[model samples]
Target: MRHIDCQKRISLLVDGSLDGPAVREALDHLTECPDCARAYEKMVSLNNALTNVKPSLADSSLASKVKVRISGESNSAGYAWNFSLLKQVPIWALIAILAVGVGDMAGKTLTETLNMHDTSHNLENLIQDNGESLTDVLIDFGQSENGR
Candidate 1:
């Protein structure tokens, strides 16, 4: 078998889980390849060390502190909305409303301005078509008032 295949089965070999042709092939590869032999030795040392290690106990007060933090009882301030003040308001909604208001005002002003311009232009055209100046029209109106 290839060195890679033997290396993959090294863990199973240490655990006594490999059997039959696989075990024989892995053993043969380990004997022929110096690298595979070294890897197998390291795996054996690691397994032995892990098996000899004893489990450790945590601090007695660690569990109580974690429980208090999770329940929010560690602080006396009483959970006063932990988020930002600006987050309470819908800022985009207000901005959209203001934009619509400004647009409406602009539209109204534009319409009024265009109407005034058109009125003045029509007045000027009327004066020109009648071949009369401002002074002549005023004098005619005054004469008609006096005759009345």
Candidate 2:
């Protein structure tokens, strides 16, 4: 077997999950390859160390507290988060309005500045296309309004 193949089998070997033939092949490879042997030794030592570890919890009520929080039985801490978010709503709204207003003004100013030289010629072209100038259209609007 290849060195990498033997290394891959090290975990299953440590867990004692490899069958007879595969175990023999992997052990043969490990004995022939120093790298595979070192990998196997490291995995075995890590497994042993983890197996011997004991969980230490200083606060016994910590689990019960977590359960209460998850069940929503105790909500004193939850309200502070909700109330703080609610209090910031108006400030956020004002900031959004200010952003929109500034954007609109900047857009208008940029367009007007960029199109300054073309404005009069563009208006005349538009006015002439439909047989109506600005003054003629305004007069027509006035006549209609008077009729209304």
lDDT of 1 by residue, 1-148 (tens): 5657768898789899998888897888788888988999999999999999968656768788788886776353344444444467698987998898788668477666556657778886755546678799888878988999
User: Superposing all C-alpha atoms, what RMSD in Å does each candidate have to the true structure?
Assistant: 22.2, 21.0
Candidate 1 overall lDDT versus native: 0.78
Q: Which ten residues in a row are the worst by lDDT in model 2?
A: 124-133
TM-score quality measure for candidate 1: 0.36
- TM-score against truth, every candidate: 0.36, 0.40
Query: Which stretches in model 1 have alpha-carbon errors above 4 Å?
Result: 56-148
**Model 2 C-alpha lDDT versus the unseen true structure:** 0.81
lDDT (10s digit) by residue, model 2, range 1-148? 5656667788899999999998898888788888878999999999999999978898879999889777784476578788888788888797998898788667467667566687778887744556678788888868988999
Q: Candidate 2 regions off by >4 Å? A: 70-148
